[model samples]
Target: MAGVPEGPEAEMLAPNLAYQEGFGRVFLVCAAGRTGERMRDAPRERLGDTPEQERGIVRDEPGETNRIRPARLAAVEED
Candidate 1:
């Protein structure tokens, strides 16, 4: 849901577009209880991350995602 501003929604997505350009990919994070400012600043904070540091971040995200997926699938299946 984040990337370069394009299509008819470019104006609305300007911030995310900037984020994508700053980072190698879209800014992905949990926003459940976060403010807009926090979300906007999170990726920027990591702008100076080294390749190894970013690799560590990248490696962790998928594990977190994988951990969530099955539980979510079970919850939906129960419903």
Candidate 2:
């Protein structure tokens, strides 16, 4: 899950859906704010940069490579 908001809605819905689908792990990639703050409840290992950032490629394990290209953030301003 990416950019999912941090609140009761995400807290309640995400785990339930993951459980129903029998997902062993649920990876949430949210911004560094409320979501990051709330994630303390779970055991987490944080990365320095987000996956889409230019320096976000991680090769921790010998054969495991997580390569993600940089992506632009899309937003709309209220007029």
* TM-score winner: 1
Worst 10 residues of 1 by lDDT: 4-13
Once fitted onto the true fold, the runs of candidate 2 whose alpha carbons sit more than 4 angstroms away are 1-6, 23-79
Instruction: Summarize candidate 2's per-residue lDDT along 1-79 as a digit string, tens digits.
Output: 7878677657655554543344333444432344534554332333223445312322332223122222222223322
lDDT by residue for model 1 (13-34), tens: 6655665786667756655457
Clashes in model 1: which pairs? none
Q: Model 2 compared with the native: what TM-score?
A: 0.22
| Top-scoring candidate (lDDT) | 1
lDDT of 2 at 60: 35
TM-score of each: 0.54, 0.22
